[model samples]
Target: AQSVTQPDIHITVSEGASLELRCNYSYGATPYLFWYVQSPGQGLQLLLKYFSGDTLVQGIKGFEAEFKRSQSSFNLRKPSVHWSDAAEYFCALRRDYKLSFGAGTTVTVRA
Candidate 1:
């Protein structure tokens, strides 16, 4: 079985501050990783994904994630976050046709 965990339930950051959302996964073999963002009342949108090859994958909206096999972590980062970045972020793992998601992290931006 595969599972994803997002340690942070909510995070607050000032506008223009750097942001890092932690994600960890557990699986028997190498797992496909993904990051998705969802705004209030909106469908989930893919932010980025890691399948094979590069451990560092670039995502949309100035986001990037690094996959570490040793630690089984795929943490998401933003160099500088904007107020508009406020949303719920989820880390998901896929193996086969099923996708399991983390609890989700809510990011809040203060001006």
Candidate 2:
């Protein structure tokens, strides 16, 4: 089966603390890896993506991710998180013209 899975359904971190969201997938080939963040009742925002070349990619809202081809994973990380960062994170892969998304991991930042 080719799918993306997020181990944690939810995560809570203190404001100003570091955060990491795990994403694992099973695919025949390296599909286009992407991380998107969605605010409450809002559409998903592109955080980062792994197409080719570099395995590490940076994105807006102070987020970054490293693609590990051997492990079949692409994890999102932020050194310091703010309250506004509290949102849902989704790992996705381009499957044909469609995309497969993980169930999503909700992030809660405590102040």
Candidate 3:
């Protein structure tokens, strides 16, 4: 079984500042990892994904994540955050055609 853990339940970031969200996964083998963001009253949007090859993967909205096998982590980061970036972020692990998600981290952007 695979599970994901998002250490931060809530995060507050200043507008135009950098932001990082921690995500750790527990699985036997390397599993497909994904980061999804959901704005208020909106559906989940794919931020980035890491399956194989590159250790660092970039996605839409200037977001990127690095897959570290040693740390069992796939943390997401954005160089500069915008007010619209405020949303709930989820870390998911896919295996056997099933997806397991983390508890989620809610990001609040302030000016």
Candidate 4:
């Protein structure tokens, strides 16, 4: 079985500050990893994905993620967060033709 774990349930980042979200996964082989962001009353939007090649992948909205196979982790990071970045972030793992998601981490941007 494959599962994803997001250690942080909620994060509060000051506007223009850097932010990082941790994610860990359990799977037998290298699995597809993705980061998605969802705004209030909106569906999940794909931030970035790691299929095979690169360990570090960039996404929209100034977000990026790195896949570290040795650590079984794929963490999302933003150099400078914006007020609009406040939203729920999800780390997903795709395996066996199914996607397994974490509980999610809600980011709250503070002034």
Candidate 5:
């Protein structure tokens, strides 16, 4: 069994501020990790993913994530967030064929 947890339910940040979203997972072995974003009414879009190789991976839209095995964390970061970046972010874990997701973190941006 595997599970993902996003401790932050909601986060508010000013435009141009650096943002970080936390994620933690539990699994018996190394699992595939991913970060996805969803707008108000749109479907989820893949932000980034870590399949293998480097622990630090770059993603679309100035986003990046690091896979920390010791901490069991895969946190997402953006140097400077825009108002458009405001959306619900989810952390997903996949093992074999089953995929599990975190509760999701709602990001709010203020001008």
Candidate 6:
């Protein structure tokens, strides 16, 4: 069974500040990893994925993530986040539509 868990239900970041979103998974084998961002009540946008190879993967909207085998975690990071980046960020596993999602972390960007 493959699954993802986001501990933080919501996060608040000042404009131009750094942001980190945590994600942990349970899988038999290394499964396709993904970070997606969706505006309120909108579709998801692919941030990045680590199917294999480099554990450190880069993604869209200046987002990146690292795959840690030991902890079974893949965390998302951004150097400086803008208010426009404010959205509902979801961490999803790539094992068919049966994707297990976190309760979604709503990012509040303070201007």
RMSD of each: 1.1, 1.0, 1.1, 1.0, 1.0, 1.7
Sliding window of 10 residues with minimal summed lDDT for model 2: 24-33
Model 6: how far is 73 from its true place, Å?
0.5
Q: Which pairs of residues collide in candidate 3?
A: none
TM-score of 5: 0.97
The residue pairs that clash in candidate 4, if any, are none
Give one digit per residue, the lDDT tens place, for model 2 in 27-108. Answer: 8876798999999999999998988888889999899999998999999999999999999999999878878999999999
**What's the residue-level lDDT of 35 in candidate 3?**
100
Model with the higher TM-score, candidate 2 or 3: 3
lDDT of 5 by residue, 1-111 (tens): 438999999999999999999999998798799999999999999999999899999999999999999999999999999999999999999978988999999999999
What is the TM-score of candidate 4?
0.97
Report how far residue 89 has shifted in candidate 6, in Å: 0.7
lDDT of 6 by residue, 53-100 (tens): 999999988999999999989999999999889999888877765667
TM-score of each: 0.97, 0.96, 0.97, 0.97, 0.97, 0.92
Model 4 CA lDDT for position 2: 38
In the range 1-111, model 1's lDDT, one tens digit per residue, is: 438989999999999999999999998888999999999999999999999999999999999999999999999999999999999999999978989999999999999
How big is the positional error of residue 89 in model 2, measured in Å on the Cα after superposition?
0.6
Each model's lDDT: 0.96, 0.93, 0.95, 0.95, 0.96, 0.87
Model 4, 1-111: lDDT tens per residue?
Answer: 438999999999999999999999999897899999999999999999999998999999889999999999999999999999999999999988889999999999999
Weakest lDDT window of 10 consecutive positions for candidate 3: 1-10
Candidate 1: regions farther than 4 A off = none
lDDT of 3 by residue, 18-110 (tens): 999999999989779999999999999999899899999999999999999999999999999999999999999997888899999999999
